[model samples]
Target: MAIKYIPYFKDAIQGQALLDNFVRTKRILKYADNNEVKERIERGLPLYETEVTEIVGKESDNLVIRGECISACAYLKENNIKVDLVYIDPPFASGADYAKTVYIRRNPRIEETIKKAEEKLEIEDLKTFEEKMYGDIWNKEAYLNWMYENLMAIKSIMSEIASIYVHLDWHICHYVKILMDEIFGEDNFKNEIIWHYSWGSRIETQWNKKHDTLYMYSKSEKFYFNANEVLEERIISEKTKNRLKYKGAMITDRNKGRGDQEKALPTDVWYIATINGMAMEKVDYSTQKPEALLERIIKASSNKNMIVADFFGGSGVTAKVANDLGRKFIHCDIGINSIETTRDRLKETGASFKIMDIKDGVNLYRNPIQTMDKIKSLIPGLKNEDSVSEFWEGAINDSKLGLVPVYVPNLMDSSTKLLDIVLINKVINLAIPELPDEIKKVIIYYIDIIDKKEINDFIKENLGREIEIELRDLKEILSETVVDDVLEYRILNNEIVIDSFVSDRIIRKINEYNEKMKAQFIVKGGKTKFIEISEEGLELIEMVSLDCTSDKGIWHSDEEIKINKLGYTIENGIKTKKFWDGKIKFLKRPLRIKIRNISGDEIIFNVI
Candidate 1:
């Protein structure tokens, strides 16, 4: 069976943080109007309504629940977005410290000095690197803990016909294997794919570790398996000489035989070619596996359009490759630089995707529940009311469920008012308006608690049979929605997350897409030796042109030019035009001409 997953951490969390939760937790709770809750209602224990979400196209049911895996798994189990496939890469636990950022000095003499400064780290980025990437989040213990928990949660989501792949190095692979076996059943253990590469770095004291392990596990005997999706050829060269014989004399001639030494089934111990120099892709996100390496894994496991997720999406290399191969993907990283890396890579491909952040929950989309519910409420017959707990709980699950409680700090006699909530079996049922209001100033409410007994008793006392009574605390979960009077838009935690959907504007034309309505940029190349190209050449152009003025410290110099943070390169040999504003400057045929240095390095340009 195909796996389905839903984000349910919000449900499993203790307490109702809303106003409606107080009224309902103290009273009887009813299931909201939705097909998923109809069965629960019949069971006399209706689950909280799943929030209807803002959706564009009718996307597939495949889900990618975004959370630190551990908390995420418990939440998924509480809800129902079960998963089918699991793959991840964890810390090897090798003694080497993995900082949030890395600083590389050109010479070995400065290594100790750099390490000393790094040890006495003040601001995050400076300590990590000369070329700092993402040090802030990379060094957080919280992120590492989240990774382990996700593995735990993933097990519950996996179906009987599901399998998981955990990638690890010598440091943590063994421990992760144990963890996987414990999470997934030990009986369902699959192969340990040893990805062997021929070359890279080696140690003089010992043999260099050139391969990594991919631990595969399945829930049961049957799983989704595609036989021939592997695009990679198993053999580098034909062994015609090895075909000495097939079997007995009658089976085949001496020259033509199905040689046992010839290419056969690709073993779990795959030895693929290593990625040395610029292999097809433009940049190498260090620790990135070769395309051929991932190709074999995909071929052995899935087919096109299968939903794939990578939580530790470092450079987003795996997800990018998966996308190119026509696979749907969900990849995330807590590190800012890593996310930037993913965004840049995806932008290059022009891939359409939603940006999800943990802090804000669903970043985009306005919750249309109130508008839809208000419409239904206006109709006399359609006014089927669920208890306040049920109402708010249901709101939580709706993909379009947007509930930002207005926090009036001094609304009550004391400093503030408390909106207490009662939940039952993770579904909020009762809501009790806290310690009375000093003035009649309106206070927003949310759900907080859902004790199972409280729900049962509330339902029995009110409606006879046991019904769901969910409690919620408004302050605990909900935030104030900033309704922009001028913009007619809502603010999410102070961020002006532009909602393109249902916007009043009729997009007569997409202003951003019009190439003519552009900020003209000036690009030039400095003198060079031969028509050669080094990464330095590209860096110089970018430093001077695209780099921001405030961040000029990041800019460096090359042989031909000195670059600035704004990506404006100063050609050292020949001076450039001072007032290059709006002129029909010609490259003579952009990308065709070779702007070379004395040492044979060349540079290319993409005008836009």
Candidate 2:
């Protein structure tokens, strides 16, 4: 077949005879959904419910898991994050189309025979069919821009005493070298390290040449470089420490001489290609660079705790080596297939990884519900009374308070209601028992009868801003009990968290309260701990109760919940039942109150 054409980076690998046309093995599609495959996610097995977690065994040295190389560079530039050394073996952008099959849901290329219509190519979904191929980039400007944007981001994230290595061939190597000069500064330009690897080639016209260039640059005039870190010096038999000691004494050693140190600090040309695919060190990426290549550059340049960033993280060779060597990494790639492949490659090697798995065309899989489930798991259980007492609460005395699901991205939306709340899936808050279980977000609505006269009186007296019921988030009314007759929120995390097990109405109420009071709750999940959700819409604060006394009971005044000290100082004042005028007094200061629950079996608040 004719070689596929790439306009931009063609020259880089064009003249170069393809070395590893099929050297690399098949890498795991980390993103592909394989029903048979099970991953050991960082989050421990659920006691009962499933939860999402960050990558397992990640290095603290790395910044964000999904960090971009350019993003890492930004941190280096801004001095926000740190980078001591950087290495990138960008795609040669080989225009020639390499061959491979395609799969979805981890299925083999069942549709390989079918031709993928050209129109399907433009669409975002990458399920089209055609023989897999590799090609160089067409637009040189676009490629440069793409490389430049990331380089700038990387520049920002590097340190002053850092170094960078750009590995390439003849094609765009010089062009990229120029770009590097612009990015790192010509003054700090180090050496163009030449790597010489020889494979048998018989060229009828000209002498066969074999080597790749590694351009090293630094941030400042000074950077870290350890001589010991360079490849171990080649030693002759006599040069061996033991042999040298007895060299003159033994005839065998006497003739042996010290191996000449290929002096002059490994000049422009380095003649060595450590290992190719046939070697056991082989990995899954088609462009899986040898670890020795990266180790040489990394060891020669930076020390421990330094950061590394790579943009074209094909197969994540740089990240894997850097991670194993005790350095942090910011790895990025635009290909969707490569994201998962890179992630798994780094992971299986036991090198900690903060992976940025990016893929194109396929839908962006948003996995953020972990945070909600964590919060839900911490809820306190409700205590049910004996059969006789349960009757009083379940039937006679307790009133039905409804609960519902709510989906509110923003509380400022006009479609929300005072009573309607969205129901978040149990997996997010309360764990749900279902496969492919998604958080069931819905708006809640409930209506209940109360003391009409007292309600009206209180509404009139307080001069409370009457909520525009119709204007607020209102939903269709429903009458039923899927779980119970009434809904209530049990205490959890020292706050009134949504008792998803309680009333669906309460869920809606919490959601409505979030809308009305602008309470913050977790939205995006993907957490394993108590991380704060700022856009949570409403603040989940601890409540402060007061020991104020009233004619009928102890009273506390509070418009919002507060975490208060003992004896309930009015940090957040205690609230009580309002009677005479119906106008509720929003107390700002401590008020004198009395207790009425003589039995102390319950706590009561009566506002005077």
Candidate 3:
């Protein structure tokens, strides 16, 4: 009997263009909404508005983008760039929150604050902390849907003769396999590779899951796979040599009857060591894969200069190995840390690429409190935090007057509004009149700018009582304030220069975190000292690496250099920790540099 996989809720996948495209494309058939589906497929998927931030190498060599994977794929498709090979190592849905341990330098300015505390302070106190990287906790349904959308986007940009390797663990591999089968067709399913390692925890009652599944599938039967490129050499034993001559004449004797060796192409099982603490390739990322593993997949499925992509580009091992193997790549990840780490890794290899970010202002809209606070700053006499309410038409503290709300649509589309006529009528006729006469003043805040005459007509037509209305325009306030600082760089002679370092930003952010920490301490009634950095904050730089040329195999000059806050250099196989002069200089032309701070925060930039 033939075997088949059925995902948890396969029937629920309807009207989603991504899932439909897989079946529609393979069978040359149409779904129910064929027109919309065809139009979407033809026009390519739409992505968040993105702007290119930096370009390190040549414009065509590689791309490192910071955005969600599905959006990144849409961006790729819109540009007419198709990839021949894709290897994604998405979150394994282990329900564990992964974090990175960062060591922050004990600021000298905090020494006095520590001593003034009620608790005795020690000079040897540790300042290291943990920060959550990404959340892998997801219910099965949400995970499947998220993966389905991304996989669909990925599939749309794949060349007809391409291969995709989806890396997953035992937790959700079975479900994902069924998803792939539904999307890519069962006949095209190729291998279920087992990548075994030996290091994690072992349960007393259950067998240790030391292996991960890598699902390899081709877009079509004509997909490329070069076996010779990834073949492993095996030594011929005497027994095998004797068996080789079983016909008494030897089968054409390519080895001159010696049977000395044979090339053993890799099977579905791959045994590669996980990155250890001391491994040269280790970059301290929690989910970093081994370079050897990526190398084999890249070589076997792709050729030099062909486009290779990894959407869940955690640790950037896929791109690093692809660059080393002489392939153009497009790496995408949503995390700022992932983007920074990948940029640095690519720069260390001297690979030229562009960094882009989604330009849509959705993040601003999502934070209502911060958005409201910013709006409050622009309006006079609205400084009282007690008077502000996040919801519309809410009573103020001990006051009969309540706050009213209005909104313009998104900046991109101003015709929309949060409070339509019906909702406005409810607030004016129902909520406003019920308030006591003492609440004569109604503070009206507009989330965005709109025509004032329309607002006046609405207020005049609806209100029955004499109420003083104050209006504040959030759009005007946002326009006057700077949104974000865009970073750029250039290489002059043997030196790299940038617009500005992140030192001040780092200090400001640390201060903000410290303020929150202080709030927690106050609630707990515990003694804690506030952290602060000194004027010479550049002393926080822990390490810097540079790739002067577009060669992945060699770094221009990884010479031993010293940095403050405990920096180390490796020479020959020994590691020496020292504080040396922190002067970094590199040859110009296609330069990439990665600068890391003591707190493990890093930035990767390219100088054109």
Highest-scoring model, lDDT: 3
lDDT of 3 by residue, 1-608 (tens): 00111121213334443345465453432223333332333333445567776566566558888766656776676667899999999988889877765555433234543344324444345354455676676666546655765676787788989999999998989878877886778899999998877877789988977889999999999999998886655546654543222112122233454446565445676667788877988877889998988988999999998999999897899998998999988898766667767876776676877788754333331122233334444444343433433324233343344443322232211112222344355457665666556566665545422346676789888778888666655555555653332234455676544333345434654777788889989898998766655554444555556655544432333322324233334221234552223344554444556666654445555544
Give the Cα error of residue 191 in candidate 1, in Å.
0.6
Model 3, position 157, has a per-residue lDDT of: 81
For model 2, how does the per-residue alpha-carbon lDDT over 316-366 read when each residue is reduced to its tens digit? 767777778887776655443355445445544555534332211111111
- Candidate 1 TM-score, C-alpha based: 0.43
Residues 262-296 of candidate 1: C-alpha lDDT, one tens digit per residue: 32334466566766664655333454556665555
TM-score of each: 0.43, 0.42, 0.60
Q: Give the runs in model 1 whose Cα sits over 4 Å from its true position.
A: 1-67, 71-83, 98-148, 231-263, 282-284, 360-608
| RMSD, one per candidate, in order | 19.9, 27.2, 12.3
Give residue 481's lDDT in candidate 1 (0 to 100): 28
Residue 608 lDDT in candidate 1: 20
Model 2 spans with C-alpha error above 4 angstroms: 1-53, 63-79, 98-134, 199-202, 237-268, 356-608
Q: How close to the true structure is residue 452 of candidate 1, measured as C-alpha lDDT?
A: 36
lDDT of 1: 0.37
Ranking by TM-score: 3, 1, 2
